[model samples]
Target: MENLIIYPENQKQLQILKSLLEEMKIKFKSEEQVEELQDWQKEKILKGIKDIKEGKFSSNDDVSQKARECIK
Candidate 1:
């Protein structure tokens, strides 16, 4: 048995890795790091959630399109 840590940058990458793992039938378990968040970190996360609920977040496609426009 071997243990490895995988830190995916974002949810999309995480999903892709999960799909590949499933396709390959690899046995794996996911564990989120347990840590106490600072007061500021908690506030920031709450604000982000509120913004998402208020439809203030941009989608992946929107960000990618903006990046392409900047590159052009």
Candidate 2:
């Protein structure tokens, strides 16, 4: 069986689509799609959050200053 995805903006539209499908005797399944993150991606995000909490990141001004020094 092939799966088709439908994106309805509101409840009214969803109900209408459901009614249409039912009237036509077409079988359909509605489900929420979830995106799973890779282990490395989760680890990187956690590390970034931890670094922020620990005040371990440089400020934009510091970065700009370093760039200017390098360009000189």
Residue pairs with backbone atoms closer than 3 Å in model 2 (clashes): none
Worst 10 residues of 2 by lDDT: 27-36
For model 2, how does the per-residue alpha-carbon lDDT over 1-72 read when each residue is reduced to its tens digit? 777889999999999999999999998777654557899999999999999999999999999999999999
TM-scores for all candidates?
0.50, 0.49
- How accurate locally is residue 58 in candidate 1, as Cα lDDT from 0 to 100? 99
Model 1 scores what on Cα lDDT? 0.91
Clash statistics: count for each candidate:
0, 0
Regions more than 4 Å wrong, model 1: 1-34
The root-mean-square deviation over C-alpha atoms between each candidate and the true structure, in angstroms, is 14.1, 9.6
